[model samples]
Target chain A: MAAGAKLDPGKVRGEFPLLAGKRGKGRLVYLDSAATTQKPERVIAAEARFYRESNANVHRGLYDLAGRATEAYEGCRRRVAAFLGADPRGVVITRNATAALNLAALGSARLLGRGDEILVTVMEHHANLVPWIQVAKRTGAALKHIPLDRMGRLDLEALPGLLGPRTRIAALSAASNVLGTIPPLAEIARRAREAGALVVVDAAQAAGRLPLSFEKTGADLLAFSAHKCYGPMGLGFLVGKPEVLERLEPLETGGEMIEAVHMDRASWAEVPRRFEAGTPNVAAAAAFPPALDLLEEIGLDRVRRHEMELTEYALERLSSLEGLEILGPANPEERVGLVSFHDPLVHPHDLATFLDGEGVAVRAGHHCAQPLHRILGIPSSLRASFGIYTVKEDVDALVEGIGKARRYFQG
Target chain B: MNLDDLYRDVVMDHYKNPRGREPLERVDIHAEGANPSCGDEVGLDLQVEEGRILKVGVRGRGCAVSTASGSILAEMVEGLTLEEAGRVARRMKGALKGEVRPGEIDMGDLEALTGVRKFPVRIKCALLPWVTLLEALLEKEKET
Candidate 1:
């Protein structure tokens, strides 16, 4: 496919009903995809169909309705594994990326000890960082943070020095939410492996925007949220090697996960079922396949291409404005899907408010990466993130909005 | 309900050029207030003489609504009796809580921030400076 060719912006935009709604006598320009993607019609319909037709508890029921629900639920697991280039046996559905990371952290508590280290990058969302921090506090393990370079990308060169024999786990995001920089996961995984530390990759931002192959990425564990990938909320997946999962203890223990329960104790079921303690989000899980199909139909490569183009255009336009400082990688090639910038005279909240008045939606505040913000020496920034449905015109509107914000403050 | 009203020209002017930006020297009372949700912070200093209000100053960093509200408040409380300043603070609180409309605010400069009543998320930002003032006054009352 030609660059940005496969996805027809009009057709893709039509698939999202929220886009059709009127906003301030103009079309809604959604630039907050990094927070959560707007769901397509197919995904929404699939969720409705699940509730309308295939609504039943899985695994426990033996009736036709139950069997169908179980099949659909398990089928989603297989599709998610295939999407990440992993085996279905290794995939377990969780609430969201945060829960997935916590599952891994809590399960691995057995392996950690006092003075043992868990390393994470400064650019990690609290979802990835806080769990490890909690794990360290609980297990008496030392929490170490790998430093980010000036561009807000992790420095892989410093990995060796941070990793040691006591390093038990290394968690990092595949893409920085604020910077939009894709990190070198494979190299970091390799180094972590050499140090006998397991690598956990938070692909919440990377999954739908980029092509992710868990096998090739070399991460022992991977987590991503379906809501961020144009699917329904309350559904996410944790993918890992089967053997690694076998070593884990379930963070939650209840009906679905237990094979048999006695008065005293219980034996758990298999890998996925064991991890899924209670009723899974059946409707949301059923909704995921359609979202995956939609992404495949448009093609991820084309989606990435369109986003990169828009990001480059935004960077070029935004940087030219006086008093505007673009954060993250200056080179568009190093970033993906999003751009964050600061207007020295205007706080990000003011900018967001101004843009919201103009019918443009973006994110402000720490973007849940306070350490990175501190390192960048700014309180917060305004971020505009793009997705498959985004068009060049949307970037134009955003650029115009930024100009308006600057003028509003300056004049 | 239009949140843009919160960003009025008068509000922006105070935000851009806040009065009492400097600290009061030999300050009798100092107190800090922070909006944890958005990390907006403000520090207020008071130079009190007996029961009458002598001088009030504020220094802080935050969104326009916050800084402007701080400037308006610093200008309002100075030269008023301590009891009168307390009444103004109560009225400001009532305005923010939606108990009083923008027109009901008798304090001239403080009325500019009345637009903040619409944006619920920004209410805390607008109140951060006033919260610091209250803290400083309470601390001074205890000292005496």
Candidate 2:
């Protein structure tokens, strides 16, 4: 199948209300899906319908509305667990990936001690990195970063040397947000396990784009955000082994996350409920199933195949331009559904501004991975991240925009 | 959102051919400023002679807005008294704040960066070098 052919780009485009509106007399080519995927009308309507017709706090009242709300909320948990190929007892819904990672870090802090180390890759998002850093600082544990190779791929050969008796947890991203390189998680997890360390995978960039089976990956905990997967914002999941979840203390405590309350002390609820404190985003939770359904309808293998072709096509076209330096692996198979490049003649901000004028929306900046950018020896770069909905036409428009920018400057 | 507006002819020229691009190995005042938000950073070195900016040089990595802003500031500040440099910095700040027009900025190459006011996210990039210069000046002031 051709790129964007299996999925009707026009029909899919119409599903997003934002795309229906014109910004500057031009079609909106959203290349910043890595930042946040555009929500479909189905997802939006699902959320709105819940609020308009069935609005009630869950797990509180015995009325019909409350019963329906509680069922819907718990039903989302089961759907999310199945989506991650996780057991229902192991899934905990949080505000976002950042919150999920923090919950794991805070809960695991009890097991760590002074001089104990947490191994994380340099390519991790701040959400993953900062929490570990904070945990290390608070516990007097050491944090060691696994460096990437020249092509932005993780150096797994050095894993044996890095992992030691002091290594407690190894956190890594399934796919990099800036460079788009997908690390070899299965191999890394095996190495980490051999060293007696638990593996934490940040699947925020991989969940919807790739096949994510928590069981096969052999990770103790995996965190992912719904916003990046065309689902509603402020909803994400942390899939952990049952034993791992049982060991972690709840990061936040309040209404609904309790088993028994005495005058002075209280016992927390079960695995998923123990982690979810107070009221949750019921509408967002309700919207997730449809988003996953859309992905399922298109099939993830086809999505991956389509994105790879488009990204390869983009890389081939963008690299042909003068003074352009593409970051990350040169081959498409070594990376995910994105490309980050720097123009020697034009700053990324300038390139992005010109692209924006042409109705192309590519992200230009450090992309929240400043440390990795510094390691790569660039200040910032322009990133064109693709998704299931991206097409070859979008790549052509991007190339055209780059050409315009180069000509406007060099001419 | 016009790239031309942000990358004015003069700004691009300075970015292409920046003045004071070398390092001042024997500089007296040196400081670095980093904007962790967008990863724009600058290291500045200044030689103060009799309470005046006798010489200035900067080195770092950032966007065209930042590199050009540094070049423009470097070119305009040389030979000016420390007080005058402070005044110029204030005027540039006012320009960035939209308190003054690009035409009112009399600091030669400095006016090229007046277009940065249009891109709010890039204002920090344009100011990275100037902030480093300010910090260096303040540190020099304290020494005397």
Candidate 3:
């Protein structure tokens, strides 16, 4: 089920209960994987099974039950590390990608100060952008945007000029949620390294879809949520170099994060535990492996292949509609699995509502990228994103729905 | 609810040909409202004489429901006093949910928005205009 294997989407769709559409189900087409993927029946069962048999707090237990809980939780950490080809010692579990990115930002305070600059792309989702803005504000550092080209690719030519002596952190998204723009992270990482800046990646949208390697990319830190990667929510991780993990501050400073506490001061725990300050989402962590195992079996390369064909067809059909425009790169080779578009004759919200009525689910709005929207000069846009469960029929349904929505609104 | 019920022709009419969008030559009050989640923003300007709204003007960018809601509300409140407009604004929220008492309020053309009732997520869109109108009234109170 790994590389070069052809994935049968119908077979994959059957694995997801919601997508399988049991009794009273209609022609449900889900194209919002960028938001969150539909959990497979096995993934759901794994979570329920955890609660039924292994319901115990992780860490701080000598008994067998606690040992099982700790193993279940730590097992997930190892799996996530192996997924990204990173060191598990540096993986600190957080609530979600936003929390992981926030931890990365807040803890990177030592690397930023007055007159330093934080570089983020214009295509960043608010998850990656807002945190850096806060870091810049807190540290008196300047926040600058790496502008996008007309086709929505990051302007790499201007990056050298931007990566001057003051650049402390280059926060980049491995794949843009809205535009589906995948930047050359390793190249940017190399440049940032030469500039003596730490490279932080937001892979929330790319994790399960790309054959990503944290070590190979040479980025100091990377963050992604499990929910978007076919896993459950309430679980995310910050993967980084073990030494890099030590240098950052922990935003949460209580519970398990402490080593020894006095009335006046306390010592913090080592690496990841220093960052994970509380009892974690063990059930979700236990549930996550099945999802990752499924993707690993199907292969990220296969998933990428499947989504690309659907996306290529979607981009062609969507743009073929009268007055419709695609916001990002039209080439499937240039991006990942999503396509964001707008019809001049219909508002995105109206179109989205109309599409929902037709049983085709998509996301409509800035996709938490208001800055990218401003660059594109659109208030908002509609996005049809693909997942392992997506089929060619779904893309056809999306096209058909948009046509009907336009006629209804124009009438 | 059916899509037709939600996007009634009457509602779409206001969306396509919105009323009260031109800038008022004179203004007594102004307020800007934005629904951050949906990315809808509406600016309201009113010409009031002794509590009666003489003219209503609005500038907006959003979906048909929000634009139409703003247009419909601006037209209905044109000849009404501040207190009456306040009552209408307050009543529209209830009206969206079909919760109006038998003789309590005449929702009139606002009923076109009843289709939005089925979509709990879009309720905010239908209420955006009325919310802004209330904000404008509150600002007037601060001045007085």
Candidate 4:
């Protein structure tokens, strides 16, 4: 955390109250950031301060408090737009990444018909897959999956063949939650443009971990969640180019999205508000800026450096264990601070139970990516993900815990 | 929070070498259960003759607690009437929830699973087979 020094989680962990609990040194090692991140005390305090000092229902009241509340809510829109190098008017807030994907999918139904194609990558979380599947079912469009290579990376050569004349939309994840696979978006976006397909990116896993630029990625629409990025829960964003966002229709119809209201007929608001239908989560918006502050303080490049070191350390130690096979690329540079592995001799559920006794938390199960699990020919895998607060000792604890589980269960 | 409490020796033995794991050739009623939260699944087959359950075939893939619970249910339900099996299942469910003392009935090896009650998430793993067996009993008009 100091100038010209390595990241020290001993100092960084002090910012999180959960890690600062009754558990002593080496008693708890949380390795499940892919599921959800632990909130910092500052982010928690900002939300409490908003409710305690300035809290009001936004966009309806005409009082000074209402104006402050609206500014506090709209303030995050500007902050996020600036952070991602996007236009402020293009950001539409939602409950989570799934809501944003559903909104994008529902809007795409207008562009498709029978025989039309929706090209998607096979390395998607269900959040990115199910919505498009429902849209295909509704509009008679065919859902096409771009295949994966032997190492679980996207088969880039097949993209040209899959993106045909009728390819209306191309949906893909910026990074995979299960295999830790990160796709090359610029190349995919270039090919999608040749076939005239809209590119929708699910950045739920890649947002804060990587230095992301919406304009640079050439995506027409991008979505990400707040909770995964150390921001508050119950808030997410669906950002798009102004032209593309304007053409899409609102998924939910409610009070906040009206331009003019008649008993039987009503017009919609402008680009972003038309998509945001209901009353927004103002407290979470007020709390979100501090999370960005923490990310900026450490700097994304430093975060990347720290995570690469953590991943390499973890992959090396874990691969040395007998019968342990990692799911993704062996190189840490390809992954985004997470490693998923499986052992034939020990089930993930049983391993997770033993690890819990050692105070090491991990994710075990299909991770909401059942299709990927089925493709890999396994019921479940264990994931140990790192955050900015993760230190070398944490990875050592995980390796030790896994070694104990193998000895206890395999014998 | 002790691992020994949840992963007893008897539990691991059943997990390593499961019993009645092959699908039955003939069954009167069939039911399948899956814990989607953990992605564990199981299928049950009942061979009922007259009023008694002649056999319970178990097939599934999961952790020590789940496979052990299935193996225990498979061997424990043999030769009991469908009504008696259903009663035993309901009582076992109650016992895992810590709602009753399981000593009233002769639980046999099924008592090995009572420690699973301490882990709230794992209780589902220990109960999936028995619940599916109860479902099989109900489908053929056999319930207490």
Best candidate, lDDT-wise?
Answer: 3
Tell me each candidate's TM-score.
0.94, 0.93, 0.97, 0.95
lDDT of 2 by residue, A1-411 (tens): 354656555666777888778888577888999999999889999899889877899889899998878877788888888877889888888899999999989888898999999999999888889999999998999999888888878987788789999999999999999888988889889989988999999998888888779987879999998999999999988999988888887889888899999989999998878998899988888888899888877777777877788889999999789778998888888788999998878778777877888899999888888888888888889999988778789899999989987787667
Candidate 1 segments whose C-alpha is farther than 4 A from its true place: A1-6, B1-4, B51-53, B79-91, B99-107, B135-144
Stretches > 4 Å off in candidate 2: A1-5, B22-26, B99-112
- The numbered model that scores best in DockQ is 3
Chain A TM-score, candidate 4?
0.97
Sequence-dependent TM-score of model 2: 0.93
**Taking the true A–B contacts (Cα pairs closer than 8 Å), what share appears in each candidate?**
0.27, 0.67, 0.60, 0.63
Candidate 4 on A96-144: residue-level lDDT in tens? 9899999999887888899999999877899999999999999999999
Worst 10 residues of 2 chain A by lDDT: A1-10
Cα lDDT of model 3 by residue, A1-411, tens digit: 544668889989889989876322366899999999999988999999999998889888888988999999999999999888888998989999999999999888877889999999989989998999998999999988788887889899898789989999999999889889888888988999899899999999889988998887778999999999889989999999999998998899889899999999999998899999989999999999999999988988888888888889988888779888897887897789999987778889889999888888999988999888877878889998999999999999899888888788886
Tell me, by TM-score, which candidate is best. 3
DockQ of candidate 1 against the true complex: 0.47
* DockQ of every candidate: 0.47, 0.55, 0.71, 0.68
For model 1 chain A, the run of ten residues with the poorest summed lDDT = A1-10
Q: Per-residue alpha-carbon lDDT of model 3 for B43-109, expressed as tens digits?
A: 9999999889999998877799998998899889999999999988888877876577524667777
Best-first order by TM-score: 3, 4, 1, 2
> Cα miss at A320, model 1 (Å)?
1.2
